[model samples]
Target: MPEPYEERTGRRQTGPFAGQTKSPTDRDGRAVTFEAGAKQPGYVPPLSDHLSPNQAHLGSTSAASQPSAEDYLQMGIDKHEKSQGDEELSESAHYFRKAAEGGSAAGCVFYGLALRHGWGVQRDEKQAFGWLEMGCATVMQKPSTDIVDLDRRQSLMPMGTQNKLSAEVIMAIYEVGNCFEHAWGVPGTKRNQPNHQMAAMYYRLGAEQGDRDNQEHLANLLSQGKYGLKKDMWEAAFWYRAAIDNGLSPIGLSWVYKVRLLANQIRAGWP
Candidate 1:
């Protein structure tokens, strides 16, 4: 019902990042260094939002070495964080694009966001939604183990990779639901505008994965019977309770209690 983001506010939504690192290389192409816990001039947002601590470890890059998918993603983070102006930000987006092309799910998510907000790039809501969806569209499969190989190695996934896969999926899912709920980047015209049905579907997917914000969103929708759902106050209470336990906003404590009470009373004589 409301105008899309680019249409609503005159400007774009801005926010992205999680980490600190030595500049990697200086003018002479020598390694640069930073003091631990010291905030350098022109500090920027961190990679915390998109990456777990394990995944956010500082990475090094040099002109001579080829960058991997992860490297591209990290380079983008560094650029985005330390960017002095649109030029650097644009460079950051370029790296994110390369990361995505090189098969980084987190890369897809960040690049999608950049497109969505016109961060360092031109705004294109449709493409933003596409990249976001692609980030979560497929389950990251372990490379098939050769039947000839013997051992537990086949089933084991690196913790960092696992964490990256999980966090990125949840991030992409939440963003998708948020887009649907707000009509930010969903496809189509009238058929695509702020559809609560689609939003609820995506929220439930993340809520079931223990995403606090998703749980809250789903709970609100259930409580109000939005999206063609029958008002199920008990279910609403259930999700709100889950959200509370999961933390994040720590929202709806009192409201959840009242809703549970109201649900108990309403259902008491029904069955």
Candidate 2:
């Protein structure tokens, strides 16, 4: 958690990311190199399905034998894109479900998306939450850095042999957090109540991975002292800057830094 070189050189590292700035360290003290993946392929694909939103999560196990979860996910993505009718969208969701059950974190995310949005599947948030959590947990067990460049980066040690983690994989994690953060905002059942702790945990996961949106949300929590996170202006500023580095506009980071400076000058005892 050393100060980012961005605070030193006063410039964003827009060139070769290797050796140009401080690499985050792994839990084992190994320096963590960034390797980010972007938006999931065929995300929010054309929607129309014959299945009722009440469909059950079954039969995916009986799917026509596939090689691996990646293949299932690819099939789902491709099918969704090529879906010619309602029944086809259901076919896409079926493949996504197959991939999810096959243990592809990305597959879990896509399946969850299908469930939540009623895209050729049951619009069931409860089921969606479960699948999404499964996907995020997979990533949690095997985290990756989130810094994109002209090309996809690599984390040879941590990621092991999994398919390259993508924003889609991380989306599963982030969406779970989103469910918790805005729960009560909708004024509905108990499910709507915001679970700050859950939100904070997932947000921090995505943020640490260098996801732009998650960094800002985690920073917002720190600044507001919500989500069981203690108020720490410095940490808030850090994440704000991280968000900007990942693609968020600099205006928000600038404001936070300015606020941190003012707080310090006023001797408000803020971190």
Colliding residue pairs in candidate 2: 53-122, 183-192, 184-192
TM-score of each: 0.65, 0.58
Best by lDDT: 1
Candidate 1 lDDT, tens digit per residue, 85-137? 66787899999999888777788888997787666788778899888877776
TM-score of candidate 2 to 2 decimals: 0.58
What residue pairs are clashing in model 1?
A: 17-46, 17-47, 18-46, 18-47, 18-48, 19-47
Model 2, 37-123: lDDT tens digits are 623322333322211122123223334564577778777877776765556668888989988888887688778766665657756
The clash count of every prediction, one per candidate, is: 6, 3
Regions more than 4 Å wrong, model 1: 1-65, 140-165, 190-192, 227-231, 249-252, 258-271
Question: For model 1, how many clashes?
Answer: 6
